[model samples]
Target: MRAFVSMLSGILFGFGLALSGMMDPSRVRGFLDIFGDWDPTMAFVMGGAVIVMAIAWRMQKAMNKPVVCDQFSLPGTKLIDARLIGGAALFGIGWGLAGLCPGPAVASLANNLSGAAIFVAAMIAGMVIFRLTERPAQ
Candidate 1:
């Protein structure tokens, strides 16, 4: 049941990304290109997501356990560190250059097989590298 719900949610999210034109690298690039023909569509999408997530967070706070899960598995860390900042910088650079983050890139694989495949492959590689190189939390 939990797996089914997770799959359904992922499908819905991918569909939303496709409908919002987020699956298109050009649209994402336009949104990031502040000095060029800037696009505000992604901003609206992100704002909507933030609002929805805020409501969801409030609802989650009131619940003891998730409908499909035993308990909520939220992030434990709250402190910002050098690794976080460095990872964020690298992510921003990659997003600016390729105009596709993980979610959108995976969603885009249905339409753009080659590029999305490459991006996903590299992303996996980066994750592996990070896992191997990162020091255990003190």
Candidate 2:
């Protein structure tokens, strides 16, 4: 049941990404092109996501447990540390260069995008390296 829900959620999320043109690298790049031909589509998409998540947060606080899980597996810490900052910076840099973040990049794989395979491979390698070198949380 949990697996089915997970698969359904993934399918819905992928469909949304594709429908929103997020699977297109050029569209994402345009959104990041602040100094040039900027695209506002992503802004709307992001804004909608923020709105939905804001509501979700409110509802989550009211709920005792999640529908599909025993408990909500949200982030444990609110700490702002060097590792967090560095990871965010790295993610931003990759997003700017590749025009696709993790979610969209994974969805782009199904489309057989030209550079997506390489990007995903490199992303996976980076994750593996990070896991290998990660320090124990303090």
**Predicted model with the maximum lDDT:** 1
lDDT of 2 at 40: 95
Clashing pairs in model 1, backbone N/Cα/C closer than 3 A: none
Candidate 2 lDDT, 1-138, residue by residue in tens: 999999999999999999998888899999999999999999999998999999999999999999989988887767898888999999998998989899999999988666888899999999999899988977
Per residue, candidate 1 scores C-alpha lDDT tens digits across 47-126 of: 99999999999999999999988889998867888878988999999998898999999988899999999999999999
lDDT of 2: 0.91
TM-score of each: 0.94, 0.93
Q: Candidate 2, clashing residue pairs?
A: none
Clashes per model (N, Cα, C within 3 A):
0, 0
